[model samples]
Target: MTLFIGIVIFLVTFVFMEFMAWFSHKYIMHGFLWVLHKDHHHKDHDSWFERNDAFFIIYAVVSMSFIITASNTWFWYGLPIGFGIMAYGAAYFLVHDIFIHQRFKLLRNANNWYARGVRRAHKIHHKHLGKEEGECFGMLFVPFKYFKK
Candidate 1:
């Protein structure tokens, strides 16, 4: 593919990952796989990591597989796709782990409209502490109601 097309594909993939994050968080994480995701809602462990972190490894493996395929095979578009997944994963880590959960005591002063909205939405979501009756499964694309002044 052309450079422009590759960039477009990369951008699209980045955007698409938001929806995937939402869908996976709602249906998969909160569904049959709640056993792994429950720790994220509640701090039942003394360790710094949660069982939900397994999903990061899964996505890393997927991105690495795409990259390996691109390097060894003829499908070069996989490079953009792989990087897009990796970039989204990094953003998710920053926003969810660092900003929202304060896992590292960073971004605690972001205090912007988007930051406030995201934090509020996530706080509302964590209020459930259970798989069912959860709201705001999204990370980036939060509902506007949370942003209202």
Candidate 2:
């Protein structure tokens, strides 16, 4: 029963991370913290990294905290929660950075309906080079309108 509960908690946390991603991207990243996220939209530096990468570090720290707490506490639930957050972060990095932005050039030839849709939606979002007026959407749950025919 404990294992089952842990699995459920993990799945729930994974799904909830999507909402958290959208919320943070829209309000926090594009809002007051635009200073960190602006370089993501506009390439102001020659380096391969952006200040926006700090957000990934923040999430990584949160996941690590949960894992460490789970290791020391009786509540093993934090283990799954931590893995769930890390998994979502991995997916986000692959889809957003690798696939969409071609940062690593690994999944460069992945051509599919879903991939195309994600690319299209992200392109629209990047259409605006500023903090405001860009359409921010979840990586896993892109709008149907952006889907290919």
Q: Which candidate comes out best when scored by lDDT? A: 2
Question: If scored against the real structure, what TM-score would every candidate get?
Answer: 0.96, 0.97
Any idea what lDDT model 2 has? 0.93
Q: What is the lDDT of candidate 1?
A: 0.90
Give lDDT tens digits, candidate 1, residues 25-86.
88999998999999999889999989999999988998899899999999999999999999
Residue pair clashes in candidate 2: none
Tell me the tens digit of each residue's lDDT in model 2 across 1-149. Answer: 98899899999999999999999999999999999999999999999999999999999999999999999998688899999999999999988998889899798888888888999999999999988899999987899999976
10 residues in a row with least lDDT, candidate 2: 105-114
Worst 10 residues of 1 by lDDT: 135-144
For candidate 2, what is the TM-score?
0.97
Stretches of candidate 1 above 4 Å error?
A: none
